[model samples]
Target: MSSSPRRPAVVRRAPGKLFVAGEYAVVDSGNPAILVAVDRYVTVTVSGSHTPGVVISSDLATHPVRRRWHEGRLTADGAQGGGRPRGGPVHVLSAVETVAGLLAERGLPVPELELSVVSTLHEDGRKFGLGSSGAVTVASVAAVAAYCGLELSRADVYRLALLATARIDPKGSGGDLAASTWGGWLLYSAPDRGFVLDLARERGIEAALRAPWPGFAVRPLPSPAGLSLQVGWTGNPASTASLVSDLHRRTWRGTASHRRFVATTTDVVHAVTGALESGDGPGLLHQIRRARLELARLDDEVGLGVFTDELRALCDAAEGAGGAAKPSGAGGGDCGIALLDAAAPQDISYVRQRWAAAGVLPLPVRVALEGIQQ
Candidate 1:
């Protein structure tokens, strides 16, 4: 039976993510990246709907939007000409539609759900670029699925969330989605999104979930035994999608340089994975530096604008303090992560001091061990 209107609300939360290694290169299918889920989160609450359609509200938006599926996609109530829903978050809506599609395939009626989202992934109304999009989507999928009497596995939730976000950005690596789904440190490889998208279009979301996704894989990695992850926020927020779009639009897009980038980045990611597995802290830091250099080379070759003055300062400060640091994701300006000797409290303090002097704010967030949580 569908969740009754008198049933209690269902709440799910998902953690934000940091890209430890691999950036632009992970966009291509089968390429690997390292991502760690952070303590910051996006929480989604689903309740019985009172409106004729689903009502959605988010701290990120100015007002709630009422929407109902049109054919299959969510459309705003009273929308003229069947326009797409307005003032509605695309990620949340995608999760809803994807899960709704799954329920339909199961011969179940779609329940009317009112969703409310609150996030700690931002500060002063600005984002930290800590995979807020991915976190929110994962949380939404879990919450809605649970409310509708479906209990999904971690992998199933991830597959649904991946399809939702991939619909928004086809070239995305989905590393953030993986991190948000599994939590902790992980080695992630991109699936052939083309293959999965085709499967979804032809068969359905349920079929896509059960199918073996080519080139997509994730394995957990232990946290370094002797390193501390320090995060520094550059007050400026960056649009990862925009930064990635720049790379894809470049004349260097399909060139030999891009291929070299993919090969070299894959090597760095492998080293990072091995270091974590062996708890080799220093080796992990060294490879992290190499990852930063690889990203710098990619930027030089493609003018991808992956770094800004603030992010450079963020990394330089950490390096000066004897730690290895780099922008967590596509850079531009967001957060940079540093790996410092866990035993060297002094060095960690010094890195924080230097970041402060350079106008970078230190964020106190740890790697979250859980991803989407009930």
Candidate 2:
């Protein structure tokens, strides 16, 4: 326990992201993706604590866990307040540890704190595949770092969050982090994860941030002109990590087919980005349909199950309503997005009704104007 005086809570929230285009292909460094941050958020609160160690509570976890932060590491002390913590809060713990690493490097005190997270991204502890993990990690990093007296820019926060996330899942593209960091509609590409991690391991977080990340980039794009975005949940959650890892495990990973998939996906992403930038709604819609077909072809070739029955229904309904739709992420099953002409409210309404009839849930969320913020 600390004898230090108590401090007010520092609260930060990060909005969940939905991939408008580019899914499996985005995993490759520099492969671009379009994403938007939604109003749904995961909020993290960090405050001074009298506890002997760190106490973490989150809506997604069954029980809180206590951890000891020593020398930039967070070691599980024990379960707190109930049955044993199952894996505890991995993303939050990683964020805390990553921040501690930076603080230690700067010769600051690593104080014990109470960290709590509540998310609108999940229901009954089930994620809607709205980038809950990413939002939580982003929010936790900002909140914890702010509580520890560290001031960070959005880029700084994103760098730390990516470093933290890479520590847990190296294969991640960090597209979600980018969306959660910047908010609104943006075009994003990931750096080489392995390279970033290696740089951090050999040098430090600060060193890694200062170093040139070869393939990573983020460019904000205008929201589709005169087009409205719609989202539908398949109710079945997916393991993005699993779907992605499955791609790596397959013999298809480095094969010619994989190369073709990457090339085609990259092309579609660029074209969609162009349409978005030009405010060509029809062109954007055309590109989205192409993107969906591209994923469908990849699925057919590799058997990745990119399109679930519910997701297919979701997209079909959108198409039936004369809109464009596609699965959002790695897409074993999660969410799909639809784009309809804003002037045609009836079309949007029809799509939503069809989605509900197909057992897909329509999420009433707008694009968030800010990313991780107080």
Candidate 3:
């Protein structure tokens, strides 16, 4: 028999991402959306030892476990007080333990690992529509795979992350996870079958490949310096799940207004994609303005102001400042993205400062080409 002990586990890293389109539309109908991995990322390091322990530490949570426990509910009286224990990180740990167990169940060797996480995105509760949680979950799953020496596909990892996060927040489309896992522009729909892949090839990699990557196109634009953006916060945060539920509920009532709004969104998204491919800045801005108008129509039809008054005012200000604004995620209130043409960095900075004085936060970002990997 071979005598060498298993080598110590190494650090694994996975990139995070943001979705460019189809945020809310991907909920019911199978309409494709695009996403790109951002430079912001989360890295997980796994260390193995003969001793039995599992530890995870990151900004969101930290848990150390000596051994596995039954996944059943713990009685309040059983915790030294001996009934059921107060809930804490146990659920998260339980999820992690389940992953480890799945590997063992599959007849794969398992390691007692210490996992450390380092993240460069959203340390606080401010999600900013940048897909932070999806990135972290994807990173964690990657760590587990590395610990188990497994080569599971990105799709499997994305599915697992979705299941795990759903258990906690009970919301979200898996588009962010797919973007962070697979990288590049993702064409995703609601159901499984409607999804399509769009990836950017590494310089040499694309050149050597016999054919172009499927469903992907290259768009030429001036560098990000000339493309200024002003991200506006609405102060009132929204939940994707709740917004989706509301949309569904409204649609089910045979609400003519809701139907019309969704139909309009479909057309706008189609137009957005066309403008994106054609590199028509003015056309893209127009579509964004149209999308905002449709959203306003829906808000009026629903008789509720989904975007806060302050947010609307800020968007109007951006439009006055030579850009068009639209909601970044499911409305209610979260953030808005503004697109500007051939703007100097100072102009964008001044715009952000103005928002900051009013208590809205702006984040700077550019398109990215790659997704999660080793």
Best-matching candidate per TM-score: 1
Instruction: Residues 43-156, candidate 2: write the lDDT tens digits.
Output: 999998788668998877788778875444666654344333326788988998888888877878777799989999988877899999899999999998898889899999
Off by over 4 Å in 1: 1-4, 78-87
- Candidate 2 regions with alpha-carbon error over 4 angstroms: 1-3, 78-86
Model 1, poorest ten-residue lDDT window?
78-87
* lDDT, residue 188, model 2: 93
Candidate order by TM-score, decreasing, is 1, 2, 3
Q: Candidates' TM-scores?
A: 0.97, 0.96, 0.74
Assess candidate 1 and give its TM-score to the true structure.
0.97
Question: How many clashing residue pairs are found in candidate 3?
Answer: 10
Between prediction 1 and prediction 3, the one with superior lDDT is: 1
- Model 3 TM-score is 0.74
Better of 1 and 2 by TM-score: 1
Q: Would you give me the overall lDDT of model 3?
A: 0.58
- What is candidate 1's local distance difference test score? 0.88
Please list the C-alpha lDDT of all candidates, in the order they appear.
0.88, 0.89, 0.58
